[model samples]
Target: MAMKSSPVVLKTWYVSIACIMLLSALLLFPVRISLASPAVLVVDDDGFASPTDCDGSDPAYSSIQAAIAAAFPGDEIVVCPGVYSEQVTIGRDGLRVRSFDGSAVDGTPDTVIQPGELTPAAVLITANGVVFQGFYIKDATTGTGHAHVHRGVFVQGDNNVILNNKVEGRGTCRFADVGILVRGGGVGNGVAENNLIENNEVTNTCNGIATVSIATNNAAAYTTIKGNTVKNNLGIGIAADRTPSALVGFNEVTENEIGLKYNSDSEKGLPATGTKFRCNDVYGNEIYDAQNIATDNSIMDAEFNWWGSNTGPDPSKISGSVDYVPWLTAPKEEGCPQKGRMTGGGVLRGEVLFINKTKVSATVNFGFEVHCNNEKEPNNLQINWRVGGQTFIFHLTAMNYAACFETAADQGMPPAPFDTHVGSGEGRLKIGPSPWTPATIQWMFVDDGEPGVGKDIFHAVIIADSTSYVISGKISGGNMQAHPDDP
Candidate 1:
């Protein structure tokens, strides 16, 4: 005899069993434990761990990739000073990778990262809010089989920062190599905005510090390159491709095929609208200092920059649609060598005899050298300009020493202080750093092929507070080599 159970009792028993099974599954649940705070991972290629916040594990990571593999978001990795031979990629966001030793003795990091043979890049960032700092990333690998594009540092993520790093190619023979490249492909843009490339030295590559737009993305629109040293690249220094709102300022762009370049060459046909370059020392390029071609008939705003000149940027050194008015009279940042654009210094020796307005005979002789060193001292002058038995004293400073070497053909130049290379100016005289009297100094130097007793020549008109003396003479001896290319 079998007892027939009701549907309600049977359903209650099944529900109880199901509840028990659910409880068992919950007990065996697995979870990924997250660190309470950002952890510091120490990486030393030689496995020596000492200089770090975290105790260098008995055996730290021997390579940078190993440390990154074990890193989580918001973690920091400190690398010891050494040469690392491998390609590195950052996939974790909010992570910072830096050198453990911050003793930047040479303005470059001792922690060097060189791309391995046939690697694509020295370091690549594919995550947002990451920072790569204080590493000398150089292209040292060489091979025949290579990728179409190679770079020292490549950033494809947004809000990433790269500061105080030296990315050099050492004249890499790679088919195409860039020192520091920021780009946005179809999968890369949108979030690929507001990335900063600052205080970096990028040199000796095809291009230095570039923001490129490609594949339905305009990463260049939100790029910023500031306080960077971009120089000696094979191609362009600070190239912006189809950048619409990019800002480039306080950068040194020099000694390349082209200095600062912006153009409208993108798949989206975006013009360089609202792009501006300010406070940059742009000069010494082989071809063009700045080249802009706005396809949309918009003016490329490239004003307020020091283009190696005080009068203006060289017209022939620039081409295309660029607005270069209102340029900086001197280098925006100090310590840059803007030697030729305004004034020049030389070691001069001359003697002249003239008759004063009182019909008195006066003899003047001077033998001195002027050097403008913007490092320790801004300028240096130690000269005795003799007028008869007294020395001609000017109540001014070494900065007022505006001398230039030009040809006899004034070359359609402006007059007085306006003629930079012609070297003529007037200033008040100072007695030992104190304003004493006013004076006007007008002088000229002409290089007659070489320096000799009667070859190169000079002339001067000295107007003192009470007396005026006019003198002319030829270089008796010494050197009058005027460098329009040094500080």
Candidate 2:
């Protein structure tokens, strides 16, 4: 190759070598890149705009349905605080429909949607992965002029979340007026599953929260209904007519004709099996706490629930064969704490005995003796107290559980964190503590983490007089004899 090279040939050769080097470098070291976020559209009812004006700028879209129609998947639609009198149908997936004021608990949600008389629902969701949050859906109309059946919010989709919304149904009509309805039917169309309905206030309707499976084959399963206040309805507070594999927990179902109703006829091949009802305060219903008309051989697991009485739920209240054994004696709300409070004054005595103690953890149990004065027996006496982990407390003669106070790890609370139970008996025993007598309560506690010896504390307060008491004790792998003068 001792020949002389031309200048043009050398220039082309140098460029070719540079291109190969660049390609090798790129293959060896990849560069980091950032993706653009999804678009966010706005809808203001007071604005003068059209469906085409959905760029999330000034003069935003006027109608919610229009913005949803124009938006692509994974877009967000922020609604301004005003009344939108139209039916909104969401058919796009991964869309977030929120109010301008954010969450409903942040303030009074002024983003109200009152559907027109001709509309079937105030808000109808038919798409998957849609989030409808922080809005007031109300005033669904009735009569021959209006739609025969009007719903505040109707969901027929899967993996959707309906949170922090107030749904008040039309008070005029009794039948087919549902506050929030999740229907599952239609062949080839997907059944509603893995959906969440949480932190909502549903009232003044034929049915507060209803999940009906009309299809003969498919069902609405794995739906979670939690942390909702469903009350003052003409019909059932929460109805799971043919919805199986549902988790209904931590709800206040009261002041309705029926607190909770589950009906499934096995002859039709629709059985409401694998339904778990836990930690709910079901009371004040004129008819029953829960009516289970499921004819299937499968039994409904309804345990750890407060049925407004210490003697447990009356067998006459539940219609079908429900396993309500080991029911919660105290109301779920008052006894389950979400925060750790500082020890306070009380006349109660606490004793902790360790069943097993290891370097990693300890298995111990607690005992407390509460002394009451016979002369000062208050007419409506109630006791609220906490021990061990913060989430589960002991409450006597209370209706509901307390709201979650802190994060689970912050308070060292268990997932299902309540253990206290009221005594099962008759007369005053079914209500509250007996006057002038010592009430001794005991519960086992499994302490987690590196534990040598754990100290458990007790805090009790008479709700009527605001009187508080506190006590503490240490637990190790040793038995401590009870005080001779105790009780």
Candidate 3:
């Protein structure tokens, strides 16, 4: 015995069961939604057709601060080429404020930021992981009779990069006229670390590049200052006060009141250990090259630097307890040294070698000779070389062979090398390579006395393909004289 239902009721019952099963399956397996990438916001001085829309299209915001307010994390703010006269504060994380043009040196499309009267800095950064680049940030204070700490770019957060910008005229305030200031304080999880200040020309301020620790308990460490031309400042070129473990190198610190100053306030503890200074050209300052006013007994390592002389820095030039032993004899080039060799098929083939003997004393020897295949034609060639900060120029047109020695007597070597050459006097020809072949000639100098043990310091290089020419060396150190011609 089976109960038989109407066809319509059976169909309706089947439809209801199917609907319930589908709902159950959906509940068991849920669908997932993914997030999209971050967006870009544009800022232009020209009026935006739509102010609310931040799509970075034709209609953009007039002010940079407005764009920053509407931007999300990891968003880029591309500023058009114009003079922005306002105080810009970036309080968001992972935001980039860059010019539309690549760099300020790229002409025409320049992004300049000039602060108003009440503005403390042209650009102030309070967020982490931010990048501020390619802008000419200047004139911190616009009006007179107002004295507030102003800066070109004031950074207070960690892991930030300030690159390839020209910052100048931050000199209104008493103690705050700094081109680029990395204010040291606690941020987020820890103190500010790994901040890179590179490739910027910072000048005409109280201090060119300064890292000050406002918090006595915590100081900024592991800050790297490299490849920046900091010159002609009223105060110290590069000042590191209360900042520890800072790596400073390859910076042209010249023509400033004080080239480099490292001071630890008595109230603040001594600068942390492992502060290294190397490969910097510290010269032509009005006062001392480097001064260390740290009261503590901690010794800072400022080894391997060119103090504008081949004989190294005088004891009176350095203050406090700085270890500048075994200093370099010539200017250090920016970035890593490149090993170069003569290329291209030509008539002349020659190699130049610089040998340094450091075991006995701080003396370097340079040996360079070129051979030409000419029996009937005059064997005429010129050789120019630099060793121990002295340039030696020799004309080999008349002489069959000649040798130049700077002599150990000039460098106070106990056993002086033979000094018998014609052009051994002080007045010698020192000219850089011509503009045509500016890749072959390099001003090579060594740090250590061991031959081929140190890096080569080449200021300029010129490459030529001609057979008959004159060679001139720009002397940077030592007294060199040309040897008698050999037959």
Please provide, for model 2 over 1-487, each residue's C-alpha lDDT reduced to its tens digit, 9 standing for 90 to 100: 6989799999999999999998766444322122343777778875532224423335566788887887778888888878888888888889999887656655596888887652457888888899999998878565567547668877878888899999887764434688887875552264787788888998887789987776664557667787799999888898887776566777899988888887776677666755667678888887878887776656666766778897778766776667776566667655333322111122222342221221112122333222111112121222233334322223333212122211111123322233221111001111133343322221212222122134322222211122122222434432211111212
lDDT of 1 by residue, 269-355 (tens): 666544567668899999999987656556667866788888878999998988887676777644223244332223334335443
Estimated TM-score per prediction? 0.59, 0.60, 0.59
Better of 1 and 3 by TM-score: 1
- Model 3, 1-487: lDDT tens digits are 9988899998999999999998765444321122343666677777332223433334566788887887777877777778898888888989888877646644543778886742456787778899887888877554456566657887777779888888777553365578887765555543566677877888788788877665653456667777688888888888777676566776789888878877665445545544567667888887777888776766766766778887888667677888876566556641122111110111111223222211111122233322111122232333455545554443333321111122222322222222212110011123344222211232222221212122212112223342112222223343222212222
Backbone N/Cα/C clashes per model: 4, 14, 22
When summed lDDT is taken over every stretch of 10 residues in candidate 3, the lowest stretch is 340-349
TM-score of 3: 0.59
Candidate order by TM-score, highest to lowest? Answer: 2, 1, 3
Please provide the root mean square deviation of candidate 2 (C-alpha atoms, Å). 17.1
Instruction: Give the range of the ten consecutive residues with the poorest summed lDDT in model 1.
Output: 414-423
